[model samples]
Target: MASYHRVLEVFDRSVQDKTLECAYDLDPWDILIDDERWTGKIRLFGFVDIFFLICYSGEERFEKGIIIYKDNDSVRIILERARKNTTEYVVNRDALENEEIPKSYFSFEDDKGGLNYQILGLGHPIGLSTNYDPGSLKQYKIKIRRSDDLVTRKRMQRGLKQHTLIDLMLDVVRLGIITSAELISKVVTMTVAGSATDDLARKYLQVLSGGQPGTPGLSRDRM
Candidate 1:
């Protein structure tokens, strides 16, 4: 199993600069491994949303999305694998249904008469306050408001970077414990041999608890 101390030492070395910019403390190691909440959730979705008129929703394209693998080391491995698997989203009409979109927030009235009788998109009756199924448009309003915040985007971006870091950490953990311990040892430690055979099997549990590195490819367990 990879030890926390072992990986932390390596991470500290990689992010040796101590100031990661986005970090309020300006410390490179501000990214904490002991965070009780999973930072991955924030990265799974973008901070700001774009609202659009009924005109268009763009063409079909491959987009990045998130998928959870496991709560531990395997989650990291699967996330790493997924970075290569961009998802396909179709731009069909149904795709534009009521969901809050990116960068297209505005009231789009269809000008049938080009006057007071102009129709709202998808038969939304004219109203002072939104009294729709979403109820007061509270969620959409919040999404738009939150998305507009600069700090919100910063948090989202940082969360994404860490998400990928966690993935690489998972792969390193798996290699050092499950798939190719011998391979990783070549880079970090061949001197990492177990004192007892019983110690070798117990290594995986330790790796499972491993977290993201402060620097890109550094590991909590070093290699």
Candidate 2:
């Protein structure tokens, strides 16, 4: 259990800029910690310190993501541990406001080679929503209506697409078709055309290629 105060102090020093230090102001955002769901705003008093570290030494480092100071006398810190300068994190499920759908819903064989569209309802009739077995399919659906503002609609669309891609990657890993490292590499290749996964894909690529100084690596606790 790392102390929140220590984490904050180290983070403040890392930023160096006086204007970038944490002020402890609560700014709300939905975040996922490991497998648990948490809803809260960040406590950034000034500049948004979206990234920080709890510990770092000799090529081993633990990066902090969302720090939720719950009123229940407990603090939830999303951590990503990397050893020997590797780009991988220890727990890897960090997507804000996104729910994890069970991997069982995606059935695949080692030789299957790619996603099964029939099972995923990829070619289903346009007007009809695809339905999976009850209790088998669990995902967060972003309902966008015509009445939604432009920004809201765009955000929902981005979220929905990102959710779908994450599910696909998870399914690939779950089926043993590819290791998580391979999946990340594949995603980077696939996203060269550009998509919601571009930022993350690029990060993984940097890690795989031996990260440059000052570049952030992928966290196990991030999506």
lDDT of each candidate versus the true structure: 0.24, 0.28
Estimate, for each residue in 72-98, the C-alpha lDDT of model 2 and write its tens digit. 000011111112311121112342224
TM, every model: 0.16, 0.19
Per-structure clash totals for the candidates: 12, 6
| Cα RMSD, model 2 | 19.6
- Estimate the overall C-alpha local distance difference test score of candidate 1: 0.24
Candidate 1: RMSD over Cα atoms? 21.3
Identify the runs in model 1 with alpha carbons over 4 angstroms from their true place.
1-73, 76-146, 160-223
In the range 123-181, model 1's lDDT, one tens digit per residue, is 11111111122111111111111123468445533322322334444544543534555
For this target, which candidate reaches the highest lDDT against the unseen true structure?
2
Q: What's the true lDDT of residue 186 in model 1?
A: 40
lDDT of 2 at 22: 34
